[model samples]
Target: MKLKVCGLTKMDQIQELISLNTNFLGFIFYEKSPRFVLNHLSLEGISAINHQGKVGVFVNETIEKIAEISEKSNLNFIQLHGDEDENFIKDLRKNVKKEVKLIKVFRVGETFNFQFSIFNSLVDYFLFDTDSKAFGGTGKTFDWQILNEIEIPIPYFLSGGISLENIKNLQNFVKVNMRENKTLTKLNTPFALDINSKFEIEPGSKDLEKIKTFKSLLK
Candidate 1:
């Protein structure tokens, strides 16, 4: 499994994660978010980071704004963590560069239908996170067992309240899920683990030692 360290606000932290070879680096664009990247780093500052996995997370933001930021920040991927439906995604897809990938987030509660054919063609990946009134960064876990019941067609990132204590459990769960998915060629398993609040010392500030330990254990 891959690791995605999210809610970054510091250049040193970003460089540290890059040195650790973290798979994805997430930057929140939503002004309401406590870890909103613009508050700490300018668009040019974000773009200056030498990494390919930089992901810009937005919440119901306008297509033009997202495209502009993505371009300015040199973001390779875009994560929509809001109520963006298929039509909106279709329009955004057309507006952005063709190489830029899209990750549509699903804020899962205790139980969800797990039937999301509407976005099958619109997005490149699906990110499952605990439902939050605050739009994620809740540091809470939804029942991941809920995913075992269905077949996901594309790769996904599992987020929400993932910490050092439960990281092993999550690894075992993914192993089992992969084994079961082998028979179905079209089925997909989690491609990455997204960590945020649990590894933070404060909003937007990450604890490097905790993240380093987690990475060692994950290996």
Candidate 2:
């Protein structure tokens, strides 16, 4: 599985994470977020970061702004962590560069039933996270078993309360799904893990040793 360390702020930490082989570096554009990247680094500063997995996360943001930021910062992926519908996604798709992939996040709470056809072509991936008023980074996990009831047509990133101690249990989640005959195919497991608050020394500040251990644990 791949690892996406979200809410990056420090340049040194970002470089170190790249050295540690973090698959994705998430920069939150939502101004309300405590880990908002722009608060710590300028757009030019972010643009200078030498990494292919740079992901810019947004919540109900304008398409023009997203496109502008993506171009200026050279983002490889745009993670929409809001209630953006198919029309918005289609429009955004037409506006942004073709090389930029889109990851639509579904904040799962008690239940979620998506009409997969709408998003299958609209996005490159799905990101499942805990539902909270503040938008992610809550360090609270929803029941993973909830996924067993639905059929996810696309590969997805799993977020919410993922810590070193609990990551080992993901195998069990796969096993349970397999036993239920729900998935032994592409949807068998999450393509990546989107980690945030759990490994942080403080909001926007990550603990490198913890992240390094998490990466090794994934191996």
Candidate 3:
């Protein structure tokens, strides 16, 4: 299971997350989000780390702005947490040629349904998060059982309310319950465990010891 520490803001917190050797570090670009990184930080500041690719999180942002930021910041990926259509994703891929990865986040709720065909051609990966009108950083856990019913085409990251304490439980459950399921294996699917609010002292600050413990457990 790969760990992605999202909602990064401060340089110190970024350094700490990098020290954990987490696979990915996310920077929220949505102004409405509490974890939003200020524009002054620049792409250089965010990309200063020797490890972990910097991801820019956007919500309903214009393509021009996303392009400008990707160019100026040298961002490795774009995480679209908005209600973007397939056309927008197609355009983004056509415009950017850095083997740019796209992570399309889906908000899970009782009414949510699995619709992979709509996005299968557009994104490199899919991320499942708890549904909220306000977007991510909800700190709420959705029913992991819901995944059992859906058929996804691409590799995905499981998000929402993941902490050190529950990671092992979740991993065991997925392995035991999903191992024999043909639909899951048919896609050649790879899943990553995404950690967010559970390891944080606040929006951007993470507890290093907890993260270390989490990494150890995963190992």
Q: Using lDDT as the measure, what is the rank order of every candidate, best first?
A: 1, 2, 3
Clashing pairs in 2: none
Report the C-alpha lDDT of model 2 over 33-108, residue by residue, as the tens digit.
Answer: 9999999999899999999999999999999999999999999999999889999999999999999999999888
Indicate the worst ten consecutive residues by lDDT in candidate 3: 181-190
Which candidate number maximizes lDDT? 1
Candidate 3 local lDDT, 93-176, one digit each (tens): 777755778989989987567565789878988988888878876778887777766667778888888887677767766775
92-181, model 1: which lDDT tens digit per residue?
999999999999999889787755878988999999999977786789888887788767788899999999989878878878787876
**Number of the top-ranking candidate, with TM-score as the measure:** 1
Whose TM-score is higher: candidate 1's or candidate 3's?
1
lDDT of each: 0.90, 0.89, 0.77
TM-score for each candidate, following the candidate numbering: 0.96, 0.94, 0.90
User: Which regions of candidate 2 fall more than 4 Å away from where they truly are?
Assistant: 175-186
> Between the candidate structures 1 and 2, which one is better when assessed by TM-score?
1
By how many angstroms RMSD does model 3 differ from the true structure? 2.2
Give candidate 3's whole-model lDDT.
0.77
